[model samples]
Target: MDQSFSGSIRWAGDNSKCLDVQGGSPLVGAHVGLWACRADHPNQQFAWTEGDGRIRWLTYPSLCLTAAAPGLPIQLDLCDSPTAPFDAAAHGTKAICTSEGVCMTVQDTEAALMLMMLGLGSCFLMMTPLSAFWRVTAAADAHDARLGRRLGWEQPGLMLMMLVFLAMVLMDINFCPHLGREQLQLMLMMLGVLVIVMLLMMPLMMLMMFVFHGALGVNGCG
Candidate 1:
C-alpha cells in the first residue's frame, strides 16, 4: 500500500457505525463488529504493519482483520489477507478494508446509464420549479377558480418527485462498495436539500395564494 492509514474502518451496510474488534481476542474466527466505538478505544483502531497484508487490531497485536471466504463473516484471526506494505510518505487511506480480490463491478453501460439518469433528473428538477412559477404567472394573467385547488395537489407531487429522484440516486450507486464518510455525508446533504425544499414548498404555495388573492380579489383557502 502507498497510503498511510490512521482512522476507523466502517462497516459496509451501516454508515453510522464502524468496525470493532470482537472480544478483544487474538483467536481465529473470533467474530467482528461486537459494538460501536467507545471514545477511541484501542480495539476499534486499525493500522498497517510494514509487511502484513491485513489490517491488524492495535489492541491485540497478533490478530488481523480477516475474512477467509466471500460471503463469510469477517473476523480476527492469524493474518491471511494479502500483505499491504507501509509507506511513510503516502497520505491517502481507504476507510473500508476488505479481504484481497474484493471489489465492486460496475459495467460500462451501467456507468453511461447513471450519467443519463443524472442528466434527466437534473432537467426534471429544473423544470419543476419553473412549472410552479408558470402556474402563478398564468393564473395572474387569466384567473381560474380551479387553479388554486389544482395547486394544492402539487405538494404530494413534489414529494413523489423527491422520493423518485432519491431512489434513482440510490439505485445508481447500488452495488458500490467501500463508500466512506464523505460519500455518506454527501448523500445526507442531498436529502437535506430535498427536505428544505419540501419545507419551503408550503410557504411558497402560501405566497402564491396571497398573490392569487391580491391579483383576482379571491377569498378563502383553495
Candidate 2:
C-alpha cells in the first residue's frame, strides 16, 4: 500500500507499476495502472480482487496473477488470448512459460526435489569421466606409459559415463518428476563417496605411475 514499495511493469514501457496506495487503505476496488502517465487509462487500470483480479488491457485476463502460495506458479488459461475471453478448458499450471507455450508443471515439493536431483546427477555423470579422461591424457602426454595405460583403462569407463550423462539429461527433461528429497540426499551421498574415492586414488595412481616409469624407463606409445 505504501508508495515506497515500487516495482517495474516489465511488459509496459512506462513506470506504471508503483503501488501508490497508502498503508491500511482498502485495496479491494482500487484501480492499478502501469504508471502515473497511464494511471487514468482504463486499459492500464486494474481492479484489485475484483473482475477476476485481472488486468483490463489488451493482454490476457489472467496475464500476471501470482499464485496463492509460494512455490506454486501461476495457473493460466492457455486458450485465453489477449483479445479473447478466458476458456477454462485450456487452463493449466506450469513452472515455466515462453512465447510459444507453457512449460510442464513441476507439481509439488517432490517434483522440485526431483528436478534438482536430476540436474546434479547429470552434472556428476558428465564431470567424472571427463576428469578421468583428462588425467589419462595428461599422463600419456607426460610419457608415463604405465600411467597412460592405467588411465587408458578409463576409456571404456568414460564412454559409459557419457552414456549415463546423456540418458540422465534426457530423462530429467522428459519425466515430469524425478527423485524426491530423500533420494536426492542419497544421490548426493553417493557422489560424495565417489569424489572421496577419486581423491584417495588419484595420488596413488600418480605415485604408481611414477614408480613404474622410474624403474622401467617405460614411455607411452612404446
Candidate 3:
C-alpha cells in the first residue's frame, strides 16, 4: 500500500515545533514536524497506521503518542516521536481522504467554510453597532455649547479597535483545521468576548442613533 498525502503543517505552539496531521496519509507510524516555509526537513516525515479501527502515528517503535483527549484542552506535544496518533474512532469519525491531504473531504471543506463565514459575520455585526455608538458620541461631545461645537474625534482609539477587529476577521478566515485544542479554545474565547460586547452595545447604539438623528434634524432647520 504505497500512498502519500500532502497537507499544510499546523503547529501546536508558537515555535512551529509540533504539527497535527489534520488530513493526510493514514500511515500510523510516521514521524512529523514543520520544516522551513520551503525547506525540507526529515523531522517533517510521518507514518500513519490503522489499528482497532483507529489511525495513529508512530515515530519510534518503542514510543506511543497521544493527542489531547476530546473536549479536554491540552497543549499538543511538540517533541518529535513523542507519541502516536490517537484512535480516530475515539474522536468521532474519520474524514475521507483527498489528494490535498488525508481525511479532508469535500463536505468537510464546505462545513469549515460555513463556520468561518458565521464567525466572520458575527464579528462584522459586532463592529457595526460599536461604530454607530462612536459616531453619535463624537457628535454629542462636539455639540456641547462650552466646547465650541467641535467634534470630539478620538482617531487613535478608533484606529486601534478597528485594527483589532480586522485582525480577528483575518484569524477567522485563516483558521487551521489541524489546530490543537488549546488554540481552538482561545480563538473561540476571543470570539465569545466580541459577541458579548456587541450584543450589549446594540440597544445603546440604536438609542444614540435616534438622538443624533433628532439633533441633526433640529440643526438643519435652524
Rank order by TM-score, top first? Answer: 1, 3, 2
115-213 per-residue lDDT for model 1 (tens digits) = 001112222221322111211111122222122212222333555655665674465345344445665576566556545644555445334434433
Candidate with top TM-score is 1
Estimate every model's Cα lDDT from 0 to 1: 0.40, 0.27, 0.29
Query: Of the candidates numbered 1 and 3, which has the greater TM-score value?
Result: 1
Which scores greater on lDDT, model 1 or model 2?
1
The clash count for each model shown is: 3, 2, 17
Candidate that would win on lDDT: 1
Model 2, global lDDT: 0.27
Ranking by lDDT: 1, 3, 2
* Model 1 error, position 175 (Å): 34
Error of 1 at 140 (Å): 59
Cα lDDT of candidate 3 equals 0.29
Query: Which structure is stronger by lDDT: 2 or 3?
Result: 3
